[model samples]
Target: MELFFFQLLNGLGLGVIYFLLSVGLTITFGLLNFVNFAHGAFYMVGAYVTFVIVSLTGNFWLALLIAPLVIGTLAIALEQSVVKFSYVLEHKYQILVTLGVALMLQELVIMIWGPIGKNVSPPSSLAGIIEIGDFIYPKYRAFVIAFSALIAIVVWWGLEKTKFGALVRAGSENAQMVGLLGVNITRLFSITFGLGGLLAGLAGVLAAPLRGADPFMGVEALGIAFIVVVIGGMGSFLGALVGGLVVGVMQSVMSSVWPEGASLMVYAAMAAVILSRPRGLFGRA
Candidate 1:
């Protein structure tokens, strides 16, 4: 079952990327109760940032460092200028505003990078493959798995152990009370939004070499992220992780057996999950 193992590895790699993307969306929704339809567009921007930086300096590592930071700043600015106004509105209104933001960012990317997709090569250091017995794997992909695992650990620690994480959890439960305690809820919202953007950006950067950067990739990424979030349950950290892996593995395995129906299977899986548990696997009632 070398083939199965290969696909499994692929799935895990993809799952981590999905986890990174969905975790940000999950956190923002969990805390601010704000729906960010533009989350995917922010992800696209980060990929573009990596694309641009690598094209200019020929340094994948530098792009990796800078792309997320740039997106984080942009997200913070957008929150202060636009997203903050929607916090008090209904979810529908929030969706509309964020959808508008997504469209704007998509068009902006097209204007700058054109509608064509661009490829990003892995760094020379990770350009080769590792072989064991009869199996082989890409070095960059191996790096993705290890690096993402490290990130996941750091994120868990930050959320469960840090003061900021406590405040975030507290804010999610009772933002009004948190504000009553003089926690500057407005600033927290901005930071939370920025954090979401940062994670989305990081996912984009990591995914660029594997999938490349395209104007429409954000839309697809958004759909996948939503699927993961829905399957795992919104605002549930563990749900996001498990759901991402499940989706990733299913898609990867299906690709070999039913290439055309691979995407359909993801939706089918979601449907199956919904038919049984309406609130999602981990969503609160």
Candidate 2:
């Protein structure tokens, strides 16, 4: 029973990571109708940025503050220079261009940070454990879960209750109508894309201490993010949250029981979801 509980907690922590990673993808796809295969590149950038900042300042908090901003700024620049041109093109073109961008970013990271993975230690405050009765839990994992939940709340409130959220929703539904109403739909897209990149960067920073920083980390994360987006429903924030948690928990439990089939379980769940609800749990048909 204690083992199950421990695995459940670990699963929730992993789910939080997935939610942060997938939410950005969901937002970009939902509002911009752009498939950003390079989103994970920003994630990798964030982790590397955090590593550099921490190495220089010896402060995890400082890295946390600056890494996302740097990645977000880079994302905006990329959107302006490269992504914007592909927006009017077909999906195949978008995929090819974004995949190329991702490859370039991965190589850039390898050139700058080396091919070997680097470790990031949690802040001293978080590098401890908490005991609850007979079980002990890592403090950093708890922090990840709480911090991610707070972010999820803020994102939900902003998207569902704020004026900017309304504009984004409106733009996503009908860009022409929104443009006719005097809104700069292109600027909105830029902001949305940047925000998505910022979220991915934030997830990367959070994950660095646990997962380490590597050039190929983004590739692995991108695959899981796609599965989460599909299982949750494309462009659906609620779906991302639910699907992330489901996939996280499923994988965690399977790791303990089946070990080798852990990853397979996620695909199985996705297949089952698709067979029953093609649009995803919270996705609109």
TM-score of 1: 0.98
Model 1 lDDT vs. the true structure? Answer: 0.93
RMSD of each: 0.9, 0.8
Q: In candidate 2, which residue pairs clash? A: none
C-alpha positional error of residue 81 in candidate 1 after TM-score superposition, expressed in Å = 0.4
lDDT per residue, candidate 1, 1-285, as tens digits? 999999999999999999999999998999998899999998899999999999999999999899999999999999999999999999999999999999999999999889999999889999999999889999999999989888888988888999899989898888999999989999898998999999999999999999999999899989999999999988888888888999999999999999999999999999998999877899887
TM-score for each model: 0.98, 0.98
lDDT of candidate 2 over 1-285, digit per residue (tens): 889999999999999889989999988988888899999899999999989988888899999899988988999999999999999899889989999999999999998889999999899999889998889999999999999999999999999999889988887688789999999888989999999999999999999999989999999999999999989998899999999999899888889999999999899989999999999998878
Global lDDT scores for all candidate models: 0.93, 0.92
Q: After superposing candidate 1, which stretches have Cα over 4 Å from the reference?
A: none
Q: State in Å the error of residue 92, model 1.
A: 1.1
